[model samples]
Target: MAAVPPALGSWGAGQEYDKQPAFQRLLTAADWRPAVKVAVAPTLVLLAAALIAAIPSDYQYEYRFQSAGFGERFGSAVSMALNALGAPFRLGYQSPLGHDRTDRLEIALRVLPMTVTVLWCLALWLGLRAGLRRRKAVVGQLTRGQAAAEALRTALVLAAVSGLLGLLGGTEWNPSGRAAKPDYFGDFGSGAQKSGQPLITAGSGWLEAVAWTAVLAGLLAFLVHGTDALRWAAWRSRAVRGWAVSALAAGQALAVTVGLSSVTAFVLVAATSESGAQTGISLAFLPNLGLNLLGFGSGATFRAHSGLSGSDGSRGDSSWGDRSSETDFSFFDLHDLTGDWRWAGLLALVSAALLGRVAFRRGLDAADRLRLAAVHAGALTLLMTVSGVLMTRTTSSSGWIGSARMEISQEESGGLAFVSVLVANAVWALAGALLVPPLLAAFRGRGAGAPQGAVPYAESPF
Candidate 1:
């Protein structure tokens, strides 16, 4: 080539462009690898946990169809995973009796299976740690802003993949393939038509996808920033340290007790059952069951409502009725199935006392102890509220037969019982903080010799 320009000379020499522009870098797979590496394993683990949890519940839908095949079960598992991640689905159905007489049921299942939730947290932590290590190896130390940007990028990747999975999993399930055809029911005579066959359709909305993205982003940000913030606060203030330690100890105590109870129950169920499905369900929902029991122990009551409503267009008649009942019960009640629920309360009280003693040993004075109790109470109450939100589930079924349309719905208690539980937990925490510490101090003082390395209340610096 004759006298090529500088740019053309480089091109003519067959030199590769080693550096890409920012926009072009976005399209490159190597640039995106770190984020994908951080997101993929955690996402897969979450899906697996969801699948394990879902497999046990396959029996519940047996009434809808004769048997569930692998594809149907897998779809259900993906749907459950999406729901656990806060995606909402709208369910629509049309009965064979009449096309115009359609019924729509939207179910909101906010419950996060404890097993899945725990596994997701663990996986995310591991993935983030590994990603951070790799980033440090490549680029040296990252500033807070850089770390946050990386987290955000990873979160976006995770959310996008999850949303895509939700779309793929939200496919409509039509049993027998007859429900998909609009005129299949038309061939049969009026009395010969199938009544129970419902053309069911389910879909997750755009809003749900957006909401899931925001939630995932927030969770990642918290993991990146909130833990450091909390540590700084604790280091700066004795009150914060006492409260943090006490709340953590109390939480651990309660968790251990409830976890043991759940494990015991699971063991019993597994020992007695042959198929092991129930045991799997128990393992999946261990956290939910524990929280429910904790709420019950704190005097929370669960209210259950079931209703049926119907209208007959030909007869020009409509009827609607619902019945509501409330009770203070826990998973432990299943052991005896009795009205006496006093054991739950007693267990709670004992846990409180143990946590209180643990808090006292952390060298908190009267004021700090009081603060510890208040903070612990508030923390526990907030946890209960969040668990309620997560554990809430609603399901409704409706169908049309001839000129009659009917709907049946059942809802479980979620946030409604918080008030009573709050009061109960506060009382128990206060009693534990105030009473047990003094008693422990007095008992220690009366000892023949002070316990080695024990800090006496009088000598303590609060």
Candidate 2:
């Protein structure tokens, strides 16, 4: 019998030329659309989240919880919906079925968006796995340049869709209209109050609507395309490329985690300031905590590069030669600026490989995982840094003025504290966003840079 070629056929019984029904096919448009749909739901949920976020601090609303009794914060919408099936209806009071009605609704509302975010994270993981599997099947046999190009293409598409949607969703640009301005930021509300005019006008409503639409679209695009990029990475490397990609992925995950945590910190500080308490616990912190958990969980892969050991709890050493190993750096140690800068060097190493510059003579397979992680880490780190700087400046500049209660009756003139910082940070973030794509692309190369033998999958894993 003739030996079967792995590259020529599927592991299961199938022919490359065979035609199959839509439902039965793995890589069909119909199949992929579900992922897109799943991806889109979170964007819509986030859009809702942004809207809830935008409600003036003055807006009167009921509080909701995720569980019965009290204290539980965000809950999964799916869980809430199921709970609601048997929940009794109540008016004005809280319902115990989904935790109390108001709290439950709030929890449900928060959870709805979380469900999508979690899914997005999951999808990215699955996509990367698929890329690896595909690449492995064709180890030592591919056009390196073709593979790199494909990865870049996928990343670009994902970025474009995300950006467009973000613009459409309320998030593209924070509303700057007079009514949308916070009382702490300016005297718009107070002036309106003194002038005997409405604080919110119809024109502001139009702007808000436009903003929300852009943000929702951007959210959808971000999740879907980001996952797609990961998937693309899996097959862009054969044995040599795989290891490089993995390393990059690990580094990127680490950086993004840090960046996101910083954002949460600022949000916390702001919320705390508003409550008149310097050191109270916050419900908002949960999301950031969850994000950190997820990042570490995913990044563990790079720390333990031997098989799936990272997930199993065995971390490797932190030395550069032990590139694939994981380490448990003390939290206090990480806080040191010098220590952080040193790790930034490690990040640079991981990123360099993914951009197609091999380190330590590592082959494509060895480099694949790490390099991809690095790319993610690099982009995320950049975003986090940009956002962090802005948040710090904005909060500080606003200072106590941001916290002072400004009713329609008070004299105008607040928000002088950190206006300059906010402006500086915003400029930094915009510059970072603009620079990341080109920088990422530059590493992937113009043509023939993927490393020989990389294979590609026809469909996304998630």
Candidate 3:
């Protein structure tokens, strides 16, 4: 008789699972569990941060416009929270007095609160590290493909949640305006007089929501996997290692600069005698203020534009013009605020010293030093450009006043200021990189003699 067929036991099921395609394997719940585990903590943390940040703004809005009910206020908070994550709102106003002469206004604010972003990134890193640690404990080690797939899955989960929240959060604001009033006395010789009330419409679009979600998802993936990719490249190539080291040094210098700026901002906020609500608002914008200070330190100019125009191709009689006015200031000018130019000098000195320490620790030769300088300068210039682009804000309003149409606008600096900022930061970074390390080394060498308990100068880590 032929041997009986083997039963489909656990081992047989395992064999069947192994025979399936990789994509099919990934479709299993167990395969997706790690992604969910990694995503849960960061998603909760991000939503909490967004809500906390939105509170001050929501309070201010409630105080300013007491007409908004709980629903409207909550929706406003949701909108602000979404905006913090890089989504923009489309706001339009239609005047009630218009047949086809509607006055439309649109405002876009592209700035991100760096404080919230930094916190969210920290949470994400922690979650990813925890998830990886758990996976390694169970599976020994993950291959490059496995690690990449994990990161992609986590990002997709995050994006899906964000998109769903956007959809459910009530993006559009209710149209609000004053009712038309009848002229009882007929003193004005007109019929019912319509107030200059506008039917305001404000909400972010699905396209914008999707676009920002995609961007955020990509960023999450990069944050999760970029270090591993860099490490792999560094291990394979000496040039890559050098570039990575230089980039790290550049990042350290930037951290020092931003830290100094943030400290200054905190001090200023503390000293101000503003109301609690105003102070809360200021606290919410603290990161933006820090970046603006960074821009000021780098010799960047802030431009202001306020203009008024009529609908009939005529300029309004107001003094405001279409031309923008640039306010060029230096780091030293902050002495008026900080009470000393030495504070600015201190920021520079600390950053330079940090870079110097990095160079000395690596035992970089002259050529390596030059490469570090170039990399640092390039990194700083790139950061300045990014900050300028991200921090821009624009607003415009138009309305009719007795047949004389009026329009007004306010905006920040234009593109030329970004170029100027990049150049300034590059120059400063180059000087710091080229000059600081040798100076620090010389200073340290003055007391280079080894004490009885001390290691020899040649063997010293410094």
Report clashes for each candidate as comma-separated counts: 0, 75, 0
Error of 3 at 73 (Å): 2.3
Each prediction's whole-model lDDT (CA): 0.58, 0.32, 0.56
Decreasing lDDT order of the candidates: 1, 3, 2
Clash pairs for candidate 1: none
For each candidate, what TM-score against the reference?
A: 0.69, 0.29, 0.71
lDDT of 3 by residue, 1-462 (tens): 999654332323645655666665654457676666666765675567546644443443342223545555455455555554666644555544454445556565555555665665667778777776776688755556766676677767666766765666533443333233334325331221333344445454434655665566556655554556666666666677677777776677677767677777666677774766656556655656665565665565644333332223245455444554555556545646766543544554555566666766666656566677777766655544434322223333334345544455545432225666667666666666667766766787742222112123342122
lDDT of 3: 0.56
Q: What is the per-residue lDDT of model 1 for residues 280-390, given as tens digits with 9 covering 90 to 100? A: 666766666665666676666654433334444444544445555555544344566664555656557665777667656765566666776777777667656655532
Q: Highest TM-score: which candidate?
A: 3
Greater TM-score among 2 and 3 belongs to 3
Candidate 1 stretches with Cα past 4 Å from truth are 1-24, 27-35, 53-66, 88-93, 99-108, 132-151, 177-197, 202-213, 224-258, 264-275, 306-341, 386-416, 444-462
Q: How far is candidate 3 from the true structure (C-alpha RMSD, Å)?
A: 7.6
lDDT of 2 by residue, 347-395 (tens): 3233333333322222333234334434444444432222210000000
